[model samples]
Target: MDGPFANRGRRWPNVTVAIIALWTCASPALSQQVSLPPPLASNHATDPPLAEAMQRIEQLEQTVFELQQRQNGGLIEAEAPICFDAPTAELPTHYPIYDSGWTLRPYDAAKTPFELTIGLHNQFRYTGFSRDEATTIDAAGNVNTIPNRNDFDVNRGRLVFSGYALDKDLGFYANIDYSTVASSSIQPLLGWISFRHNDALTLYMGLGKVPGTWEWQQTSRYTMGADRTLATTFFRPSITAGMWGIGKLGDSLSYTVFVGNGLNTLTLRSSDLDTNFVYSALAWWEPLGEFGVGFSDQEHHDNLAIRVGHGLTQTKNDSTSTDQSGAEQTVVRLSDGTRLVEPNALAPGVTVNAFDVWLYTAHLGLKKQGYSFSSEVFMRWLRNIEGTGGTSLESLLDNGFYIQGGAFVIPKKLELFVRGSAVTGDFGTGSEVAAGLNWHLFDKRSARFTLDVTDIRDSPAEQSRTGYVAGESGTLLRAQLWTFF
Candidate 1:
């Protein structure tokens, strides 16, 4: 028993089908002229109307099939049979859409005034740190010290909120960090508002990272090791409130320029910021295409990829209004880990209150298959020392370099690396040797377990990330579970 919509292809002619198609496209009213039968199941086999409608549907299908055949592999969709349990309620005009990736976004384009995307990152760690003597003497005869640690903690946990409003090209970002080092402290890590003029330019202002070195710019979640190299910690600038210009010249060339308050002005009031400004910039070219935003050959590039970059920072530092004990913001320190602001730091009876600083950096990176290599060199010059009391001073020069390479012994699953760095300056010298491994859990960099062992001698860098205490000789062991949600 054939229904009204059964196949009856040979009854329809080509010319008649063309005319009907044209009439349907003329307007909505004309398009609905050919009515389709409804409310009849195929089991209504004895109904005359059902049989007629079935014949009309078969003719339509043949016409559509002929049109589709004229194109190569193109599809013309036909009416679909509704599911038996499908909901009959119509969709609302404005409904919230949910999306998830590294971040979770929930908003509606029609009803919401703005968009909001939330992201989270957690790094849990087991740090086993030991130092030789746990104390050392600085160039100025001041004793520096650090405590040994064997601890389990959430080293860094971050919550981020960001999205666009008013204009699609205008955006805002905020990152809150819960740091467990020193003491459990919650702080606002980054906050910025940006306007993108086009693909080539974006301008932002607020508190964010000042453009520094290539490794310093890489997202913390993607470092080649559990932390950055010691040399980077020794010379890199600190986060500050500032404005920046970030842009891409083309697919391979990119740059960032920033002007901000003195380095590590996090604890400083606006009144404490002097008229002088800290300025820095970096630009890199990936001649062989994207070298990736982070270290490692995680993507396993089949061809050679290379990137070279140069950066410079210039500033006049005045210690008059700064807190002498802000450990993270003490950007200019003697190689022996003596703060430049300390009285009699360079000579007896002389105190350094102000100084001029200029830093230059160059770096290169290469990646291919399951291997990668990267290195950077730095040069620093300090002059124009201003102090209380008559003082005779000479220019201070510091230089250092770090080289690191890695290979994926098991492709994306397991990787191992070795790194070495040193610092040479007017007061003293420091060096570090380290080896590390990353086990990408489930082959995802977004979730990985990292392990690293490092030996240090008179380390010039002092940062909590690597648990490097200034002016100390020590060995460190770290194991971390890093994940992004």
Candidate 2:
């Protein structure tokens, strides 16, 4: 289709017809014009027919000589312009880049500046719960009840669409999840339009995850357990409409800072939100190379690797609180599982309406051979309490921590892990210990089966998704098969 002289013959038909007009008689080739013998040539260039034909032949030879000279001069002046293939130029074509792993550019991106990628994450779970007691008391002197469950569930059937437009640095993302546990059967989660200046910095706007803790920083698809830890659910910030900045200072250091509408306004309308905004920031460093997102030693590092991180978040808002666990549940909870929104929660007759909260957290993680160890600590300070009924309230403080470790029993395929966590606050103290086994179906953790059993006492965490029931001691069991693409 393309060659230096591919057009060499395309421009000659018109030039040949002009040469015929110059001749009194029709002749398509110069050889025919020159075939007339000298016998036909007479005095003064012979007969009129012969003389005219000779003149035309001479002109044609000159034209041929000029074209040859032009070709030698490196210019094809009569050639037609080059063009794209007709079929591809008019029709759009696409094929999967991998149909697995990270979705990369697969839309014949060089020809089209816009790209759209689709992804999925599926998790099927089986859980069993048994409470030590039917009812338990909280710091507020209120009795709370527990419910037991044994069944199967889905996360449920999450779908993600993300890509870039105009430029690779301009990106967009949208996620939808359908599950019975969600506030609605189908709900939109995080969605954003982002500008990535470089690996060192990226800015995003829209409903996004607040950057407040290490556990929440990594994707849920790569969790070391079937789900995040109970302590993480208790201390971490929830999804909110916000703008955030994320960047890496160097090969080992990364950071994120966010400002959002409220601590837990995922389902709230603008009228329901307060005037105050929540601010959260976090930074982590992996000194010995990349410490991958997951806590599990799936990599089986030949040498030691470590990561350290710190985070802080502050918020003061007039958000309604609830003891129930749902898609948009209240984030600020008492150690003994009492909702700050509960009437007379802090005093005999006062109803607390709002509070200012500050949380500081730190974490350390280590990996070597086929083993991994990680831990995080959280401290919270709540002040500026607002209430009804003219009852004065005092500040409150709370603290919590979780430690986890794992080692592969069969190279990279099977792993044994143990985890424990505890919480202490003005209201009460609670804790849990758990053990699990993981069997990776593929080389990556993208496909896996996990099983774990946890024993909890006066559980402070109230996240039902993580199998925690506040104010009630219990033995919980979970098994899940999860995959991502």
Candidate 3:
């Protein structure tokens, strides 16, 4: 125990000296050299010990100031010149000025630029048949005549204008169309004014064509076939010569609305025509890549017409002509003969009012890439038709559906497109198959070739005989041209 005590005592002294040495070496502030000006250099300012102590305090204070600056988020100047060529100095911070403008808004077309353009198109078509048949009756009410059907006929031509007006905000368009190949003679197709409010908003109004499911929906303007399923004709007035509006809801959705005099005066009865009250609406949405849904509607008045005819000879005579019912032919015999008549048998004053026809239609289309699937159905009812003898009457109902599939080989520039349209209902009409090819001469002008085989009754299940004609089937071929500047 005595020896252990003696060794401990010796260790304590050495340990104490080691602690003192460590304390001195660890203090950078305390170890700093403190200096004061010499008495002679300082002009005999103060005692040397006093100056040294003051200088030490000053050095410690300077070190504390620097530490505070670093803690207070202060940046220190580099001791050496900074080299911009260094990787650290070249690091990206913010977008360059040139790129900043791009993220704000699209360049305005109205203020930036404008253009003017015009276009024209022409086409001809014809149809041929192997056999023709019609029903006829002779003077005694006995029927035994077959009239020959007329040969094929054709013509379709168009002119259009488009592009910008004023600067960019305004747009102008005009189109003149004529179709001897169509059911009608000549007509002004489209004319309108358009305004661009923003990238997602556009407004168009004035006399113009309405873009619907079948007519203006095709990328190639020319390929559509004639005998446009009866439904197409019924729906045309809703889409043509109307006041229409369209709006886009973001990038995935769009909407359209229109109001017009349904059908037209020439086609509909005078009583059914609406001078200003006509309207339609459509909306479409695409949530997935290539799938879409749409809805539309159109309304018009009823049309009714009547005719009467009685043959006096073997030849067919006009129901409204003098030979059949002229007032001048009236005969009056006094009491002896006991025969008196107020008017002739075929008097023009003897008017006949016939059936009233009413129509309604709707359709849908699903398209993916180059392939498309579409379906349209419509119905018409004819109420009360005066018989051939103005004394009898009949009622008829007509309805049908058109389902089709097609592919676009060249997108909008050119395409070989075809569709199979069918009809069946009150009219006793069979299904039809149609095919065609279309070509674009310019972005807005195109030409088309088409062939359609209709009323095919080869299959007993598909035959619909109405009795008005005697043929089981017929064919129509067409070449058409269309353009919109």
TM-score: which candidate is best?
A: 2
How many residue pairs clash (N, CA or C atoms closer than 3 angstroms) in each of the candidate models, in the order given?
6, 0, 7
Q: lDDT by residue for model 2 over 314-363, one digit each (tens)?
A: 98855344412222325678888787766656777666776788989999
lDDT of 1 by residue, 324-360 (tens): 3223325577787787767678888677766788889
Stretches of candidate 1 exceeding 4 Å from the true structure: 1-113, 182-184, 319-329, 390-392
Clashing pairs in 3: 109-168, 110-168, 110-169, 324-346, 325-346, 325-347, 326-346
* TM-scores for the candidates: 0.78, 0.79, 0.47
lDDT (CA) for every model shown?
0.75, 0.75, 0.39
Model 3 reaches what TM-score against the true structure? 0.47
User: By the TM-score metric, which is better: model 1 or model 2?
Assistant: 2
Give the alpha carbon lDDT tens digit for every residue of 1-485 in model 3.
Answer: 46546445434543443344334334434322323222222311344643564454444343433332322222323232222233332322211112211111112333335555556655554444333334322212234333333344434466666667555678887767676544456666667888888756567776643343343333233324433443343223322344666776776566665655442322334344333333444455544432422110000002211111110001011122322322211111111111112222113233222233344455555554445555665554444433235653344455555665555566644445556544444323444466665554542233334444444331112101111122234453444443332
Model 1 residue 246 CA deviation (Å) reads 0.9
The order of the candidates by TM-score, greatest first, is: 2, 1, 3
Question: Which window of 10 residues has the lowest lDDT sum in candidate 3?
Answer: 308-317
Q: What is the lDDT of residue 62 in candidate 2?
A: 48
Off by over 4 Å in 2: 1-88, 91-93, 99-110, 319-329
